[model samples]
Target: MRTINRTDFLSGLVVAALGAAGLVEALRMPRFEARGADPFTVPGLTPGLLSAVLCVLGIVLLLRGMSGRNLTEGAQPSITQWTRASAIRTLFTIVMVLVYGTLLFGRMPFFYATALFVFVFTVGAELIDTERRLPAWKLLIGGCLLAGGAAYAIDFVFTDLFLVRLPG
Candidate 1:
């Protein structure tokens, strides 16, 4: 078993705390009983369920980390070691998500924007990954296909099945 370092302990604590906070917030959402809203359809239901799952997973992680068993084998990187490639990938993901959430999402048609974002994000991630074997043309084609399919599926689910109107 790998040694449960301070990083694992801290990560577990943070994740559990966040999950707890989310659950609390979800619980505080309006039930809408006066409007006869179905319990399953309540705004908080999904979040509450997801938060509970997170809380359970976090607790498991926390317990595992607290076990303090040391690995008898391979070397582990220190938590303080932030490689340049890792940092770049992290920053790129953050920037892409921020742009998608704050800029592209509501500014254009849902399908087009989502497709664009998915394509760019997939292509960018593949390009950034040092171990990626796909050539540029294949990457672009795969990205496009993935993006289009994902966007279409999401759009169809939300717009048709869930009956949720997406902002154009």
Candidate 2:
């Protein structure tokens, strides 16, 4: 039986690792202060801020786990009892995210890449859901709209509002 503390500890470690990695990558983004660009307008600014927050939250969780603060909550599902379906879903999401980050983001125009990723991820997730009630047609239509809308919004906000030049 795994206690909540143990689960939190493991989750926190993973979150912290991801956050730290993101922060490192964000830091590597070009800073145009040399060209008189505002520090807040740097491409890395938002990502760095978000990553730092994630890392701090993860550290807090790790500390709580280390202190066994949730021991009183008792045992939860054991590793052996973890559902195969759940594991597959988790792994699928992770792989999709990794592919989007490493392959898609910088390889294409931001709007197209983001739309593609969002569409594929939404459709794939819906298809994989055993209890999903939405039909394939609905999923397709919804995914398309969602992808387009989200991509447009993100692009508008970053490019127009934030003045961030998204990579092609």
Q: List the RMSD of every prediction in angstroms.
A: 8.9, 10.4
Find the candidate with the highest lDDT and give its number: 1
- For model 2, what is the alpha-carbon lDDT of residue 62? 86
Candidate 1 lDDT by residue in tens digits, 1-168: 656666667777888988999999999999999999898899999999899889888887788668865444465536667999999998999999999999999999999999999999999999999999999999999999999999999999999999999989
Computed on alpha carbons, the lDDT of every model, listed in order, comes to 0.89, 0.88
What global local distance difference test value does model 2 have? 0.88
Off by over 4 Å in 2: 1-81
Clashing pairs in 2: none
lDDT of 2 by residue, 15-129 (tens): 8988898899999999987899988899998999899999989988887777766545356536535587788788889999999999999999999999999999999988889
Overlapping backbone residue pairs in candidate 1 total 0
